[model samples]
Target: MPKPFKIPQSVLVVIYTPAWDVLLIRRTEADPSAPAFWQSVTGSKDTLDEPWEQTAAREVLEETGLDCTPGSALAPHLHDWGLENIYNIYPRWRHRYARGVTHNLERVFGVQVPDGSVVTLNPREHTDYQWLPYDAAADACFSPSNAEAILQLPHYAKQRLGTAA
Candidate 1:
């Protein structure tokens, strides 16, 4: 049996902390020969109709072994940035989608965790992880979208905490 075609709709989650420390994960060397590039949690929906929040939660767990369920003990907060980016999928990655599916829709989200939170990364998915300040995380991301998402973390963090930015 063939693997299921990937859903075009995906989620980009910027995991951060109230103190503005952002979590960045380094992708294993494979897809690109470039140095291990950093990025936040990102993944596609499991099915065509899955909710973006569910996709965010699942990706967070699968990538970092962190729980973002509605009310988990850690209660790592989650917020949908209410922004979506639509762009043509990279040529090398288009094969994961159905034939002729050249574009993808990515929903942006932010997850807030405590300072110095222990991160258990899935070695198969991420070789290393780092907690950096908002600006550093943004600069470290290799993907434009991922970097942009981190750049917006301060704004969302301020709004979420009832402060003006």
Candidate 2:
């Protein structure tokens, strides 16, 4: 018999507004079989051939339909939180991960955008979206590990941008 397919480990991009508001989406909960969850732009790293940054940019575009080039600087307001989290794949998603490989390490990144940049969602990956105050966004997340990343956003902004709070 063939072995089950393992979900690829991935990166989670926390796209935000200049003021630090986070972009979140309410995943379709109509399916009673799946957990109700809200989250930001996230996807798996491609074959190791690509650089990690490329993986990040690729995910941002694939999930949000926003093409962010490697050359575009994240308006001096953005930051990168050197935070990493490991969480178990949801029971319903376990088939994506290798047998016995239950958890994934997700690296967090912050991308600052203009307050009202129109977002184009790839309907297949998400149902609805919203721009929420960081705290509110964090609270709405189904994953505590993800929430922790959001909460640490400001600190990273300050440290990386060298700005006074």
Candidate 3:
């Protein structure tokens, strides 16, 4: 039996440290010759009805081995940024969704992990990971939406730290 088509909705979770270094992971490309680009943890929901927060937590764990469930070390710091982006799906990846589906709705989130947190990449989905300062990370992202989201990190961080005025 064929796998079900992916939902057009997904979550993008930016994992960062207290010092403002953002975690970016390089995706594993099927074509070895394809250029690699870094992105934050992103994944579609298992089902259309899955809660966005649940999807965010699951993607974080699956992509980076970071547990963000309630009572977990990163749980208290998990935050929903209340931002959303609607953009056209790149042609190369649109096949994952049903035919005629050309757009995606991405919900944004941020999770603050302690400094020096270990990131274990899932080899099947990602090839490597790095923690870069937010500006640099924004420059490294291949997706414009991802880059824009990284650029907004300082605002979210300030709010999370309760320093926003």
Clashes of each: 0, 5, 0
List lDDT for all candidates, in order: 0.87, 0.73, 0.91
- Candidate 2: how large is its RMSD? 3.1
Listed in order, each prediction's TM-score against the native is: 0.93, 0.84, 0.95
**TM-score comparison, 2 vs 3, better candidate:** 3
Off by over 4 Å in 2: 1-7, 28-36, 73-79
Error of 2 at 36 (Å): 4.2
What is the lDDT for 22 in model 2? 91
User: Which 10 residues in a row give candidate 2 its minimum summed lDDT?
Assistant: 71-80
Candidate 3 ranges beyond 4 A from true positions? 30-34
How would you encode candidate 2's per-residue C-alpha lDDT over 1-165 as one tens digit per residue?
875464456777788876888988765533657665788777776564655566777777777766565656543333346567788787887776667877887777777777887788878777888888999999988778778888877777676668864
* Candidate 1 local lDDT, 1-165, one digit each (tens): 999899899999998887888999998744676766899998999987788888999899889988987688544488899989988898988888999999889999998887777889888878889998999889888888888888888888898889987
Pairs in steric clash, model 2: 6-96, 6-97, 6-98, 7-96, 7-97
Q: Rank the candidates by TM-score, best first.
A: 3, 1, 2
lDDT of 3: 0.91
